[model samples]
Target: EAGVTQFPSHSVIEKGQTVTLRCDPISGHDNLYWYRRVMGKEIKFLLHFVKESKQDESGMPNNRFLAERTGGTYSTLKVQPAELEDSGVYFCASSIRTSGRAGSYEQYFGPGTRLTVT
Candidate 1:
């Protein structure tokens, strides 16, 4: 059963360390979204990628964080100088389409990659 897969089920890093998280979406899915929950905060959207292009990146928290979907395939998220506040579960989701759903589509999420910063 192929859905979405995230690497490094859990990671612990010291402050200022760089960490990279990866995501593999379902085959043929054209839309992908990244979201996360940090420090007991509500799940926040990070960005959306349609194929190899970033369709919406308004949710990116800061410049220290970078996201990319190369070759319109798997994606990678890198946080440079990871801060203590960067510890949280990062989720990846994908679908044929997200917005303007005719009620027949739903976003499928991965188990998530938990990052611990200290």
Candidate 2:
């Protein structure tokens, strides 16, 4: 089976431009997550989607970032008016639905998209 995959391995945009990152998770997986490592900082969780519903989005940086999982197959993360601070390696991960422990399941990750905002 194929693992998660992200499009546009790299993107460079102006500060006020918009960039959308897409992720295709492994088939049959119901849990999807978005994460990023910015300014050389450790990777941080951005949001999570269970099927087509958002389970948690508390880690999203701000209103400028929007994430969506359409039809529960693929997910997209868009950053409007991108800022220099948003430049980072954006990662997408997926796994089977967790039952009890939150961190018990093994998540598969994509190669990640490197975004550069100038």
Candidate 3:
């Protein structure tokens, strides 16, 4: 019954440090997604998870970013050797699968975690 939740609402680190972000989705929801908005950029999808498997990851930027959903309960995103350009807000969302109906299923979002790389 809970909405999506993110940990460490804000993070600040040097350009080469590593940072990990976490997200917990609503119970009984099988669809989990990650998004981010960098400075001067639109919110872009990073990846999606259906249960414990990755459904889509085409949007992931590069090899420095990694995401995982263990047991499909919660998800984690890690950025290694972070760059200044990575400073942005990371958002997580979840949705319940609905029957074939346009706009029937709505995705609930979490309070984004803001990351700043100096």
Candidate 4:
């Protein structure tokens, strides 16, 4: 019954360092998504997980990023050799799958984790 939760609400790291972010979605929810908003950019979808499988990941930026959902319960995103441009607010959301009804389901979002790369 819990909403999504993110760990280490804020992170600060220098460029070329590695950072990992975590998200725990609501119970019984099969849809989990990751998003981010960099400076001067709109919030963009990074990837989506339906249970343990990746449903969509076309939005993932580059090879430096990796996302995984283990056991379809919690998810993690890691950025290696982080760049200054990676500084942003990372958001995680989850929602229950509805029967193909438009506007019938709403995604619940977690308090975003702010990352700063210097």
| Winning model by lDDT | 2
The per-prediction CA RMSD against the true structure, in angstroms, equals 2.1, 1.4, 1.4, 1.5
Residue 38, candidate 1: alpha-carbon lDDT: 88
Per-residue lDDT of model 1, residues 30-107, tens digit only: 888899998788989999999999999999889999999999989999999899888999999988854576521477
lDDT of each: 0.90, 0.93, 0.92, 0.93
- Give a tens-digit lDDT track for model 3, residues 38-74: 9959999999998989999999999999999999889
Instruction: Report the alpha-carbon TM-score of model 4 versus the true structure.
Output: 0.93
- Give the per-residue lDDT digits (tens) of candidate 4, residues 1-118: 6779998899999999999999999988889999999995899999999999999999999999999999999999999989999999999999887778553257889999999999
Lowest-lDDT window of 10 residues in candidate 3?
A: 97-106
The segments of candidate 1 whose C-alpha lies over 4 angstroms from its true place after superposition are 97-105
Error (Å) of candidate 4 at residue 72 is 0.2
Pairwise lDDT winner, candidates 2 and 4 = 2
Model 3 ranges off by over 4 Å = 101-105
Clash tally, candidates in order: 0, 0, 0, 0
In Å, residue 3's CA in model 3 sits off its true spot by 1.2
TM-scores for candidates 1 onward, in order: 0.91, 0.94, 0.93, 0.93
The predicted structure with the larger lDDT, 3 or 4, is 4
Clashes of 1: 0
lDDT of 2 by residue, 29-104 (tens): 8999999999899999999999999999999999999999999999999999898899999999998876776752
